[model samples]
Target: MQQRRDKDWDLSIGPDTVRLFILKAKAISAGVNEDYEDGAEHEVEFDGDARDNHHHDGLAEEETEDLTARELRELIGDLNVDEAAELVALAWVGRGDYDASEWQDAVAEARQRGNRRTAKYLLGMPMLGDWLEEGLEVLGA
Candidate 1:
C-alpha cells in the first residue's frame, strides 16, 4: 500500500486543511522501522475512573465558534472517515478554539461535498478525539 503523505505524519497546516484516512491507519496501527511498536495498543493508561477524573490536560480549547449546536451536530450526523479526519484537522486549524464561523463554513462546505466520517478513524497523529467526540454533544441525537 502507498504511504501517507508527510502532512499526515506532521501537518504544517496553513490556509488549506486536508487529512487522509491512510495516515490515521498508520499512526493508530503499527509504526515504521524494525523496532516498530504498537504503543497506543499496549500503553497502560491508568489515569483514574471517570468520576475522579479532572483531566483537562488532553482536551484542546474551542476554535470554530461558528459551528453552532445545530451545524456541528448536522456535520457529525452520519460522519465517515474523511469527515472525522477533517474534524480533527479542523480542531487543529481552530487552534483548540473551536468556535469560529470560518471553520463552520468550511465544515459545512466539506459536508456538502460529502466529507465527514466516524471519529473512530481519526484518533491520533494530531486529530484529538476528546475534541472530536464532544461535537456529538452538539448533535444530541
Candidate 2:
C-alpha cells in the first residue's frame, strides 16, 4: 500500500513575511475549501485592488487569470493574504511560463510549501538559483 501524502506542511519565509503568508494561506484555503468551517475567519478588507470593483466583488475573478512567472513575482508585491496563497498554487504548475526571473519569490514560495528542498536540490544544476535571482531582477519580477 502506498502512503498517503499529507497536505499540510511547515515552512519559513523571512519573519516579515511569515504572518502575511499565514493570513494568505487561511484566506485561500477558506476560498478553495467550500465546506470550510467558520466563514467569518477568512474575511478581510478586500478592497483597494485595481482589478476588482469598488465593492470588491471582482477580486476573485481577477485572481483566476494565469500570469507568466515573471509577472507572477512582480504581481505578488504587497499582495494581500488570499492573493499570495493563490499565486503559490500557480507556481507549482508554472514551468516554461516562468522567466529566469522570479527566483526569490519562487524559492521562498516553494520553501513555504515544503517541497523545494527535495525537488530543487534534485534538479542537479547548482546555478538555477543564481540564474533565477539575476533573471528575476532583469526580467523585472
lDDT of 2 by residue, 52-136 (tens): 3335444554364212222323335445544344334323223223333333455466446543233223222223233323322
Model 1 bad stretches (over 4 Å)? 1-98, 116-121, 124-127, 133-141
Q: Cα deviation of 37 in candidate 1 (Å)? A: 11
After superposition, candidate 2 runs with Cα above 4 Å error: 1-13, 35-141
Candidate 1, poorest ten consecutive residues by summed lDDT: 1-10
- Indicate the TM-score of model 2: 0.22
- Would you estimate the TM-scores of all the predictions? 0.24, 0.22
Q: In candidate 1, what are the lDDT values of residues 1-141, reduced to their tens digit?
A: 111122312212221222222223333333221123544532345555635334442223222222232333443455564444456545443344443324545455544554434332333234343333333222221
- Model 2, position 24, has a per-residue lDDT of 41
